[model samples]
Target: MTFTGVVPKRRLGPGGPEVPVFALGSWNTWDRMAPPERRALMGRAVEVGAAFFDVAYYNMGPHAEASRTDLLFGETLRELGLARTDYQLCGKLWLWEYPEAGFAEQMRVSLDRIGAGRGGPESFETVVVGDFMGEIDIAQVVRDVQAEIDRGSFASWGVNNWPAEALQLALDTAAAERLTPPSFAQLKYGLVRRSMAEGEFYGGWCADGTLALQASDSFEGGILVGKLAPARKIGADVGGIRERIVAAYPEVERVATDFGATPAQLGLAFCLANPATANVLFGASRVAQLDDNLGAIGVLERVGPDAIRAATAGLWLDRDVRADGVWAP
Candidate 1:
């Protein structure tokens, strides 16, 4: 995780940009910090090479509501006099309302808010198109994303929580058209979840070096860290295994103690252990929490990926998120 202080960096894939293994999410950030604390978060992130951020508009998906997290993030960057190069942003587009919302409209909305604070980049470094709804036109989605990339909106793009077939079709379409393919796939991967990313579909692509894996929801929206009944909205229970996930937390705690680490560290380390994971996406509202999450890097080093995987194998929640074809397909 570190030679000294810097977090490690790896390519998103062969064609994508290199980024740090720890990317922060923008879910609960709007209320967490005052001005100085936010400034300190940015500074410490840069200091530890965790400047990559996943800031998405919550205009769609479960518990959909308006959020100004991205605006505040951009404003903080401007306040600190940080250049665009000082940090990386992974913008997101939603498939929850595809074709109608489209990629262009969403990008326009996201950039306007993020840039409204000034001194922020006009575009994201990379983007993740996520939240699979019913089946949609894969060609149109890929084309729209590629068009955005061509327009310098973002350098590379990835699919989030998409069906394996959709990922395949997107790649095939990109290859056939000679357009840029999605360089990565962000999936729900961690100690409690393994099927999507580690299953045959994505693992093969990662093994062939065709796509990188961005691990998300590894903490199950802080539930893995003993926030058993968090007041804030966590991601929808895509697996329909909330009870199982909650029950497994005890094992997580036990395993983390055995490994001489916090439950948060063990959960994160489990995600990092996977060879395909380009980075682990997490949310840390406070700088102290961010620093605490960083300890997973050390835990990974101490425990080794294999031992960690084996120890937590019983906690794995393997479910095809796209099975029902109602919410996702």
Candidate 2:
């Protein structure tokens, strides 16, 4: 529970747990790490108080469904003999196929799948539930999740990749019903993809202190860090700007060198520099990468956030990719 020198802890929302500014995410990347390496990486995380984890369950995604991260994580935890209290967890309640799977059923089944009931964190500290592309009854979403919270399934909830309008409706709906509003908003946030979190709509909520910003996919599947030809599966290219992102790598590197930081450190610092970012979630498959990425904390202190943003302002990479109708599977 004793976190290292990551200054300024932020609370997730009202009644939510305060957490470190960075979190470890395992989407399709967990299995690639061998048992010994995974144990070492997690152990380091614990030692440094960087144990906040994003373990979103993949009930229905092409790339993520194929990735058995929950199974792998549970197996690894048992191997390391880590108790439930060793780390804080943020789970996801997928709305990709809502009603058919509902929040209650999803929580029970997925937590069991993750080995929670038998021997894991019994309930997540928080859960993010969104991705409402089509017709979504926001009231029902809140009601169902409220029920789950009462059942001790999760302490608080948040939105994920949801439109600003939908997120507002959820907040409004929760207020009207005297229920719990979402604590945070998880989005495709990073250097290249800043439209959602920093743009007018979502930014307004963040500015007004309505929702905490939890950034994900900040590395663009390693493309931003020079993994231009990643052989493994990555998250959805919401804007289909993989080439543009890859091309920007040199610029990223140049700016990083100028700042006396590595590209990866600079990227993490950029996300962390934003006052709204409660945490930046990234996937690292190696212990060295884990340690290296933590150097971003120093980058934020040395070069600072505004200078980093100004340095990369010419990139012109802040457009909304989904709204532009440019998507790649």
Candidate 3:
């Protein structure tokens, strides 16, 4: 399928300007494969108009063991001769360490992987603090993020997987301190999952001029892909994700049939269909997988109001009311 003409773009947030509808997710792809495989996938994603790539310092494993993934991502982009400005790069701070200094080092390590060392120019325009996981001190995290910005390490910063209240608190603290508030927030949203997008998180951020970047928008572990059947044992590789999905959405099969689109495509489109979602993050393991997902941008554009309503109805298992809530059945 040749994607002719330009892929449509949407604003990063109100008054934040526009970016491509689909963004490439590097978490599983970078961790599960070797450098060459990851590089090829990155190139293919770029060809299909997946101009944004999401990376994080701890994407590989616990601690910094997987830092190489980010390095390989940059190397591949450079090898493809794509100008840094031609693509948008978004990465996160692992935040495993607390206090401002440890957090600062985490950002520094992330920048180094993306080729933005002390004197080098930054290839990334956006940096996010990961998960928050309801554990970190929101105020301190915000302060550390601002320190990086002050040093010219990043242009913008935001939160990921944080609850609506936590996000508001961070924004409020930044206001009191006169620091730069986050410009984006990353959350999970898909055909079966709408609460985060439709609930307080979306409303709060939208009102605050912050963009919502939807990660795992496809409902990671392939629940939205319809590959794993209820009562069946998932392969050892994806067992953890599979178990979570089966537990949460026992009726996934019934819901999958209603969408007409494959689980993967529907999941991707669900996020794209929302006007509030700035971009949908897709995880592809191979070049072919990347190509297949890029087609979703077209599928999303074709989705009308009825399709969205039908897909959301009876598809979601649960909804998170709090900003830092986790939705595992």
Candidate 4:
């Protein structure tokens, strides 16, 4: 289906930039696929208006030394001859250490790799602190991010994989200091894992319109697609989160079948059905997968919210499935 005119747009936050509701995420696929193949996929997405892209600095696969996805994105955009304004690009600086001295350098490296030209912060629409795993020095990180924004690296900033309380703290700190507060929060939110969606941070954001939630891992690492592991085993051996999600596959499939949709379609639809979901960031390893996910945009209206919730009623584990959480491998 052509998304040129049908896909919807939502503001990044209350007053943030408006982005397409359905955005493409580059994780294991962009660097793994050949340049031309990945280029074709990006082209297809852009042509269909699902061009808002989510990329990170850490996902170049196991063998890579540095990020290749950013470079590949630049190559594809250049090959397609798309102008800077044609699409929106979001990048994440992955830092595990409390204070990485090379924050600005890392931003420069990613920006240069993308080769989108030096229009200051115009090179990136949004950049985020990617997946901080340990105790974070809130004020220090906020100051560092603000310096980058002052230096014109990105227009806005957000956080990924941080606890809901921590996210709220950062937001509160930003308000107290009168600095640029995080405009978004990207965490694992889907039909199978409803902990974050049900948490205080999400609730506060919804109430005050302070932070936008970017829902990731909507497929529960593919278990929500109804593609069970060999022998139909559902446990840590398959995937920590998969085990939790696999248990609900039968019911998810039945509901999807009733609506003439595949389990994958229903999975994506479930993410979109969330009113708090600003964007559902998903990864695709193939052109077919990308196209299939794009079809989810049309499911929201057809299936409606009640049916989507009914279809996924018993799926929520009431536990956070984020990496290193109770479901981590």
- Model 3 pairs whose backbones collide: 162-323, 163-323, 163-324, 164-323, 224-263
Query: How do the residues 123-199 of candidate 2 rate in per-residue lDDT, one tens digit apiece?
Result: 88899886666778878989999999999998898887676667778889899999989988887787788877877
Considering summed lDDT, which 10 consecutive residues are worst modelled in model 1? 320-329
Instruction: List the pairs of residues colliding in candidate 2.
Output: none
Residue 20 CA error for candidate 3 (Å)? Answer: 1.5
Whole-model Cα lDDT of every candidate shown, in order: 0.82, 0.79, 0.61, 0.69
Residue 212, candidate 4: how far off, in angstroms? 1.3
- In candidate 3, position 72 carries an lDDT of 67
Model 4, backbone clash pairs (residues 3+ apart or across chains), number? 0
Tens-place lDDT digits, model 4, residues 1-329: 63445457777775456887777776654776787788788877777777898865553222145657666767777777777677888877765644653578767767777773633224567876855556667777787888888887777887776666666677788889977888877767777776665565564675477777777777765677865663321223213455556677888888888887777778778877777777888777667887777777677678798888886777877564343222232
The full ranking of all candidates by TM-score, starting with the best, is 1, 2, 4, 3
- Misplaced by over 4 Å in model 3 are 14-17, 34-36, 59-67, 117-123, 133-137, 207-210, 229-244, 247-260, 320-329
lDDT of 1: 0.82
Best by lDDT: 1
Q: lDDT tens string, model 3, 1-329?
A: 64554656776653233667777766545666776887777766666566787876654224344446666666666666776666787767755445543656776677677666433337456766765443668887788778887876666776665666677788899899988787766666665455565666565565455665554545544655654552332112211233555555545445434645555555666677666677777766777666656666666667764676565666654343343434222
Worst 10 residues of 3 by lDDT: 230-239
